[model samples]
Target: MMGEAARERRQFWWFMLFALLVIGAGIGLRAPWPADEPRFVLVARQMWESGQWLFPHRGSELYSDKPPLYFWLLGASYALVRQWNIAFLLPSLLAALGTLTLTYDFARRSWNHRVGLWAAAAVLFSFQFVYQAKRAQIDPTVVFFITVGVYGIGRHVLLGPNWRWYWLGCFAAGLGVISKGVGFIALLALLPYALMRWRGWNGLSEPAPRGAGKWWLGGASFLLAIALWFVPMLVTALVSGDPEHRAYLNDLLYRQTATRYVSAWHHHAPWWYFIKVILTQWLPFVVFLPWLLGPWRQAWRQRDARVWWPLAWLLLVLLFFSASPGKRDMYILPALPALAWAAASFMPALVQRRGLRWALWVFSMLLGVGLLAVGLAALFGNPGYEARLVAERGLEVGSGALWLWRVLALMGALIVIAGIVCRLRHVLLFTALGVAVTWLGYGFGIAPLLDGESSSRDLMHEAREQAGADTVIGLVNWREQQLLQAVGPVTEFGFKQPEDEQWRRGIAWLQAEPTQRVLLSQDVAMPDCVDRGQIHPLGAANRRSWLLVDAQAVAGCR
Candidate 1:
């Protein structure tokens, strides 16, 4: 008979392997795509090149939108690997893996290895978690830090008066704050601990008077982590006497953190928006929700601190994001680990229930059939929607569109067959298999097919070819992708500059050496002063039309 330790070691490695396959499959297969990836990668690239670790820049402007910790990680990754594509996404990948490891261990220590594996699996296969893990974003790293905080505090509260773990958790939360500004959300776990203690909860550390100094130590550890980045950056910004540096300091400290949270400028939605996100974005795991409610209520009635701590933390996080006027789907991602932990505590028996199994099977069928329908429509028929997508995405109808839809169709067919074969007896297995296929399909197959146009690689390639090797190109209202993918000499007027100012600067740059220089501008940013007849369209990228123009296109107006 194998020992429990050996079994746990084997299971842990297997779960990690599965996570790596799901999240790390397409690391180098595609360049960063937009909405956030390109901007973050561009900032990191500039940081690496300029050796300016304190102040991040987007184009020629100071980037005060996010704290510098994430950018620092990206720069460090680049230094180690020296490849932009892989280096750009390395931190998120490692952070995700770290998160999974911490989740697995925390659950294992809290309940048993079986619960740990289930908890880790629940997080691994979730749509939102996998989606964010694969992308080069700050959220995954933030999620990891927050999860670490939860694990540390939960361990100390449930397992021991182990002040060391408590302090470590506090330190991780501090790191989380530097990583995203919401790291302190990790400390919210303590709120439930306090309540549980007051309520005379079972399964808590033997009541021991932890001195106030110990509590202060945790806060100091958190501050120390923040001070690692904040102090040096703040001191430099204050003493530098540079206006841009001061502006960066003010914006990052004030506008981006507190002000943005209180009054979001964009992506606004109703209060119930996160509830909708939880229902949809957190799928497969939520498929067990119906079966979970009774067990959760029972756990609460029994006063289980292990269950209450994470569940309460999850609720607090949900309320935190939901109360904000501005919301995005990924905002609730950090709460997922807690959800997985609470759910996995009951998942062992819940999986055996016939109703939950049927629900999983039904969900699998719907997902598979949905994918099949969309793939079939794109493949066999020239539907108006398909045509519009191809045009908007600038995909080659002959190759790009064909390959993408075929991969989707193939994946859907496999999932449908898996669901049918697995049936009720193995329906739980079917859900895991189906999610694995979907992510692997997306990472290895679909992402590469769309990489060229989606990353603006092809558009920049065309621009480079048309302008010749010696030509200098100036960008007007250009995206980060265009600047990142440029082959030869390139200059951006400004990323955050107004349209008129960018156009004015671009035109002047073009006129400096008209024969040797060209300007690339979005169609919407094209100035009336430019001669439309002399402008050449460079095709569509990221659903925007771009035009290449020469000084001759500058007609008359200043």
Candidate 2:
């Protein structure tokens, strides 16, 4: 018979293969989620259609709020197949795959193959990782660069003092910066390792020959990478006197970092925000905290750099992001890999102790039972629940809800079986399987019906039919999302009240243009300088929800 190690190797490869297929298949299913996905896809669509690769434009205006790296990838994807949902999500999916590969490589090289696989699987199946990686958002790419940078730097420190690895790390950091403003923060993970290396501890001792020179060269490499995009952008802006470019440069350097960090415009949360997110959103892994305590105690006893590096980095990230007033769940995505590694310290116990494995399975089964209860509740709980869902999310308690429950039940049953079996192979395999099934159910079975109401595709299409496609559409007292999903070039305008300066400017702009259709929020009032003759009120989805106005009624009121 093959040895246990040999068997685990086989299982790991198969599990990875299964995960790969599942994640890829997930891309083929599901529509976009709003407030993020549609906006991103629309921006890329606009960029692709405009052929203006340098500047990102949404509808009629330049959009420079985010750096253009993800947009470039997204626009490129849109150009390839012209499919928004899957195409826009491609970068994140690929980035996630890369991250998994690197995590596996790092863990395998540092520890055993089993440990490495466990570490990767911990991240791959992580709730946040799966959720974020499947979306067309900035977080996945951000996480990828940050993780890759840490992995690269780690090779130089732990394995050997290789110049190339150091340079690679620097390059990754540069890419991370371009990917998201705060990506450079990922390098902070290397600090504890560097400090440990200086002391020559954790099986690492003696300075790398010419390490100081490598540091300068690495910094130079980073600057060169930054110059690839930044310098040209600045020069182009200067030459063309593009006001948008000026704003982009300013935001890129200042407001996005310093101003935004100190006092934010939105997503304002206290220091405890990330703490709550870490506890609630990043559960199961966080459940392994007791498992982690042992490793930390061991590492502290041994003064081991391997353990200290990830732990210290976690501290730094928590402190850094916690200090910022502006916070969101996705903001801390880059820190998850470290958490996984730190958590995977418990994998050593799983390797040797069958009792511990049984305990873990018991935990899994208990968690599964709770999930099963919730899933069952979702299906048959209360008539009020279904009514509330329809009222709030426009979801019906139907086959989709049932399919989700079925998946959850299967998940629970499998966990209970794993617990009963109480074998290491069974535990790892079933845990990974549970994540796979959940995502599969979401991606294939449940998401279609669920997304129908969540997505704005139908509403946008129906409104266009009412307003006529040929008519120029502008939004006043409406969300930018409405314009994003609309059929044509829908102009966006209006903010607070009619008397507000920004709102007045929007009215003036709408009046100046030959707009034939206008979508307004129900609460907003019509302006006085207007032609009352051209205004027509179309039926609305909800009263006081939105107002569809025919701006073609704009008589020569001017």
Candidate 3:
């Protein structure tokens, strides 16, 4: 018979394999879609092409919404792979794997190998976790850095007075802050550690030397990581003496960070918004909360420092984000590792309960049934909403739309079968299997089907073709995807410039030569001076209709 150690080693590798397949699927199958992906990838591509790494740009506008760390990773990955399609998504995929590995190792050391495997699996299957991991978003990278910082601090406080680990953790957190301005969320772990030490909690390391020097060392490490980016950025911006560079620097440091947090300008939500996010987005894991609460209370009664430390930090993170009026669903993502660690010990037992198993089976069935119903409707019933969706997606009713329905139906059928086959015998595995199928189907099957129009590749291609090979195409009210996917000679009036101004410039450019230059613009941005009858339809993309206008479309107005 195999020993326990050997069995755990086998399980760890299997879990990793599963994670790799789920997160890394469909990487090169699609172009960057809008809302954020195209913007980041464009900035990275410009950095690689223009040799400008200090400041990121989006079609002539200085991109100041985020720091350069994530873009650097994207550019670095592109340098290695030499494929923008793969490079843009590679960082998130690697970061997600790094996060899962960290979660598994930390759980194994703190509790047992079994708990470690379950914790990693739980995180892997979480809807929000895997969804973001598959995208080119900055959150996955930030989450990885924050997890490292937490792991380091937890090693020092709960496992030992290891100063080096604490410093390492702080430094990782600093990297996280530069990634998204939330890296210091890792150091919040120390607050709960101090309280636990005061109460003489069990399972804590022996107290370290009573000197301020040790504490200052960790601070220095954090600052050093921040300085790697900040000092260079500040020095370059000051030395350049460019007004745009100075504005970018000031906006990032002041408005984007502290001012944005204190008075969030967008995505405003109530205090209870994150509560809703936790219950829904953290699914399968959140499903076990009722069972976990009792075990957590018992652990607290026993003064288990391991359990208390993570839970306390989780609470602090929730409060910290909830206190900010401008709340986004992903803002609370950094705390997920702490929550997974606290819940890992109990997952092994919670999976055995009949109530939890039944709940999971029902959840799986509902999800599967919903997808199946929608697929059937799209396939046969000709639902109004479905037709409208097809129109908006710029897909014909035949091949493009049919493939999407087929993939959904296939995923739904697979999920239903996986749930039934696993049932009460292995409900958690059912969850994992169901999630895996969903991601694989979406990645390999659905993403490609929608890529042409969703990523604006089709729209840009049509614009280029209609304008002829040698003609210069001008863009108005443009998105990054349009700018990135555009072919041949293309000119953008401005991305961040006013809609009226962009239309004015685009019309002027097109009017300069009636048949030689064409302008592509969002329907909403086309001016009254342009005759709608003369404009050729370029179909819809990114949920907006676009039209190609030439000099003939202009109604004798500048």
Candidate 4:
């Protein structure tokens, strides 16, 4: 009894530590959520301010790419922060924590506490998971629901056939669908559960009575949950005769789903793409994946109920992402908990294997050397050369690569040294510690630098100040439209627009403007009035050349 209690206590602490590490690392690796996060926050803030729940606003224009759940969450967060900045990322942080909890729960129920701990650790430290958690994007929400669905299914399957758990699974699936459209429901989570149950007779072997009534109840609950959102959306679309509603429906249902299956926008990769992403993103944990596969095959061969279920879950997820035409690096976040489970389940066996310690030590050493070399190079390297290289090659290096390099190098060195110590003592605890430290350093130290550079808050503030409150803002070209929209509403005039024709009429219209301030791109061909000393360059934002035109003097050009 004492031994069992001790084991339970140890597992509890380990799980807690795992949760803390994941959350802490995520918090530390703070990058301003890129691309989607800023837009999501802006729209949500607008929603809060305008009280427009149906139409997502980007400045004065309607922006419709996603559903309302993420925006609603961000809007609430924005109120708390008293600003629509990084605070919007709170949802992602919460989702990440939820993912950790779900992962632990699922692993513990299916396998053992050790596997649970490892799975939790993997979810926390995996590169993509950590990255997504820190960003204010929809992916973390998707991950959260997917995690919940997986855990719910795992519980239902492991604890005999329970309609209650299946209902919970349906609810989770509904949340997942609302979070990121139908893909989470149709592709990632539900299909896996169905395949696992169909192939593995583990569900039938359960001690609980399995009847047709239970299945019908479970199915009805799932359908009802899904209808709650989509049915409302459909009804709303029908009531509103707005052309924009039709556009949104087509974009979400057709373009995003049907087009994604056949065409690639931002996430087009070859079939082997997921393989590389998994290896790199999951890192050292991926090394133990082969052990899981061997056991997986053996379990299926022997028709073992315990092993086939989880293995089936893992395979379904892997196959779904692999077969999908639209693929991104972070698409593997849903599969991570399972991989972690597989890796952790075999960790003890792997630790006992001969030469495993040497291999770990060598891997740690290599990582250390690589990080050190990169850090030194970045620290001493010329900024001009770096910029030139980026410009020439269009390479995407992390903005804070130099800082990240130094931190990663130090962490890697510590891991190598720790691994060497563990090698002599043959302690798996040391190996775990080393990896944890390294992951912590990578997330916390490296993430901030990257985020600082990416954040547009400061830039927006400067632009607003330079342009002044009363300035009638206009884009120099179409390319600047998105950037200007992010800052605030601006009068956009294309080269062929009637507004451009009026502006081309000369200085009289410019001088009659309220603020007499015109923002023009350096790349655009300036009007004759600009060269005639009618415009003065106030200041630059984003290092892009922008000229402030004086409306008073432009009147003489007419």
TM-score winner between candidates 2 and 4:
2
Task: For candidate 4, give the lDDT of residue 558.
Answer: 54
Better model by TM-score: candidate 2 vs candidate 3: 3
lDDT of 2 by residue, 1-558 (tens): 469868877877786776666666557555567657766776777777878777776666666677778888997777787777668778988898888878877777777676777778778766788788878888899889888778877777776677788778778888878767776776786678768767766744235535577778877766676677778788888888878778777876788778888888899988888888877667555656655677688787887776677778888999999998889898887887887766565675744566555555565667668666766776666646545555545444576556656666666666556556644657655565556666776677566755654665555676677767776666666544566566875666532224344345545555665455454434356566444555554333222334455445444434
**Residue range 416-530, candidate 1, lDDT tens digits:** 9998889998887888889888998998999998899899999999999998998988998889999988889998888888999988888777777889999888899566777
Instruction: Give the per-residue lDDT digits (tens) of candidate 4, residues 1-558.
Output: 899969876876766666557455644244344467656766777788788876666654566567677787777776777654446667887788888877776677667676777678766656577667767778888878777766666676665566677667767766776667642442244454555557665533366446778766656665666676667777777789977677776777777666776775767678888889887777656656655567667666766545555555666766767787778777767777766654566666775655665555566566666666655665677546556433332224664444455675677667667766676455455546655676567566755644433443333445566777766555544232234233554554443345446456434445556464455444346556555455555333333444555565455455
lDDT string for model 3 (1-558, tens) is 369888888889988898899999999999998779999999999998999998999988899999989999999999999999999999999999999999999888898888898778778868999999999999999999999999999888877778889899999999998889999999999898888888889988877435688988999999999999999989999999899999999899999999999999999999999989989998867898888999999999999988878889999999999999999999888888788899998887787889988988888777887788888888988888788989889988898999899888888888888877887788777887788888999999999999999899999888888889999888888889998998998888878889998888877777777678888888885667778888899899999999888888885666
Model 3: per-residue Cα lDDT at residue 210: 54
Q: Where is model 2 more than 4 Å wrong at Cα?
A: 1-13, 205-209, 351-383, 396-425, 494-544, 551-558
When summed lDDT is taken over every stretch of 10 residues in candidate 4, the lowest stretch is 477-486
Candidate 1 backbone overlaps, count:
0
Clashing pairs in 2: 534-553
lDDT accuracy of residue 136 in candidate 4:
76
Give candidate 1 regions above 4 Å deviation. Answer: none
- State candidate 1's TM-score: 0.98
Return the clash pairs for model 4, or none: 507-554, 511-551
lDDT of 1 at 259: 85
What order do candidates take by lDDT, descending? Answer: 1, 3, 2, 4
Backbone atom clashes (below 3 Å) for every candidate? 0, 1, 1, 2
Enumerate residue pairs that collide in model 3.
177-183
Position 75, candidate 2: lDDT: 79
Candidate 2 TM-score over all chains jointly? 0.85
Instruction: Give the C-alpha miss distance for residue 31 in model 3, angstroms.
Output: 0.9
